[model samples]
Target: MFHVAALGELLIDFTPVGLSNAKNPIFEQNPGGAPANVLALVSKLGKKTAFLGMVGQDQFGLFLKEVLEKNNINVSGLKISEKFQTTLAFVHLDKSGDRTFSFYRNLGADMMLNASDVNYEVIKEAKIFHFGSVSMTEEPVRAASIKAAMFATENGSIISFDPNYRPLLWSSVEEAKKIIGIGVKLADILKVSEEELELITGKIDVAVGADMLFREGVKVVLVTLGKRGCYYKYTGGEGYVDGYAVNAIDTTGAGDAFLGAFLYQICDMKMDELCGLNKNDFKRIIDFSNAAGALATTRTGAIPALPSIDEIHNIRLTR
Candidate 1:
């Protein structure tokens, strides 16, 4: 059985390279899409993962499928659509390694994934069902994603969600919040950026925002704090862990890496063991994940930046 089954977009991220002699900027194509990136890290850590999403029948789509297979994730659940071309995002990274995107997706193939295209068998077979908010921005894909999540839950799979919010993807903040809130309610475990927490809850304090999620039936809420590490909260417990020191080159998939590492620990444990975890047990997981996130930022690209399990352990050993 697959350890995780993820359903979402598979798009290209065009990152800035440099300006030419003529003063025109160049870009390098990198494969990215939040759910794909997360599963890449999980698969990198030796977990069996499968991807479920539609991609255009184009060269870029073919390349993304190859990249996922190369990353050790199963591609059997991937679908190809003839109606829309592959989606593209022009990524701009500021001095702090923060990124913004300009998406070219007027009817992207990812947005065309209908409920009929969903892999119900894959969701039923997986131990964890993962998804992101990006696919919820449109129809058909939104219906497919929600259907998969429901099937996974019915089959006893843990639902994992990441609100990897890119403001540019949505038409309005209020609508975005409403849709993303639907994802929050469906998840057992959630990963959100500090900004995403505020966006979803309209609260500045992490604890208060996390509490809002807890009331939504979310069991564990993890708030990513970038370089400061992460803040985590669960029933009767909560704490912050500092990330390891690293000269980050890019922060693209760092959060994904952190989340994957944390979920890896969950996949390793029995449901009973997970239920028995206390505050101290959570601290160990957070520390390990923080190191993994730090290591990912020290490199470039999402899949390429993912560190090995041994590498993450070594970081903890050396520290």
Candidate 2:
């Protein structure tokens, strides 16, 4: 059985590398897409993991598949679609090294995933199944996303959701909330930014927002507060973990790294052990994840920024 499996988009993020002589932005292609980044870290941590997604039958798509395979993640469920080109996102960064995405994905390959294209055989054996809201924004792909989540549930795999909201991908805030609510209900665990909490739950406070999700059936709610760290609320527990200090160069995939590390820790424990785990147990997990997230920012790109288990462990030890 696999430790984790994720079903979602796989694409290339063209991030600003530097300025050209003429002051135009110089972009570098990085293999990205949230769920893919999570699985990359999971595989790096020595877990048996697989990725299920669609990509264009082109060079970019081939590059992504190769990257995942090189990370030691199973790609049996990955498909190459001839109908659409691979999705692309041009990332713009602020002075703080934070990013914004302008996508080139109208009817893109990642959005063309049909429910039939999903390989349930791989998902059923996973200990955890992870996804995000980006895949649910469009049709056909939306159905595929829901089907995979349900299939994972029916097969007894844990459901993990990250609402990696990108405003450029949605038509309106109302539509995003309406669709994301469906995923919130399906997930056992959720990860969202403070802005996403307000957007998704209409609650400004982190605890209030988490409480809103709990009422909707989420077992655990993780609010990622960037440099302030992460806030978590579960059935009988709630607390905040302080984020690690780092000289962040690029913050592209930090949240995904945090999530991958958190899930890896969860899967490392027996289910009953996790259930019986206390606030301290949860704290250790979140602390390790916070360090992983912080270290990810010290590097550039998504997959490239992912930290190894030892790297995270050493940081936690020294800090």
Against the reference, the lDDT scores of all candidates come to 0.88, 0.90
Q: How would you encode candidate 1's per-residue C-alpha lDDT over 248-294 as one tens digit per residue?
A: 87888888889888888798665546656888888899999998998
lDDT of 2 at 279: 86
Q: lDDT by residue for model 2 over 1-319, one digit each (tens)? A: 8899999989999988898999988999999999999999988988999999899999999999999989999999998988899999988888888989889999999898999999999998899999999999998899999999999999888899998998889999889888998888889889999999999978898998898888888887889999899999875588899998888888999999999999988986654466467888788888998999999998889999999878998988876
**Candidate 1 backbone clash number:** 0
Residue pairs in collision within model 2:
none
Model 1's TM-score against the true structure: 0.96
TM-score: which candidate is best?
Answer: 2
Considering only N, C-alpha and C atoms within 3 Å, which residue pairs clash in candidate 1?
none
Q: TM-score per candidate, in order? A: 0.96, 0.97
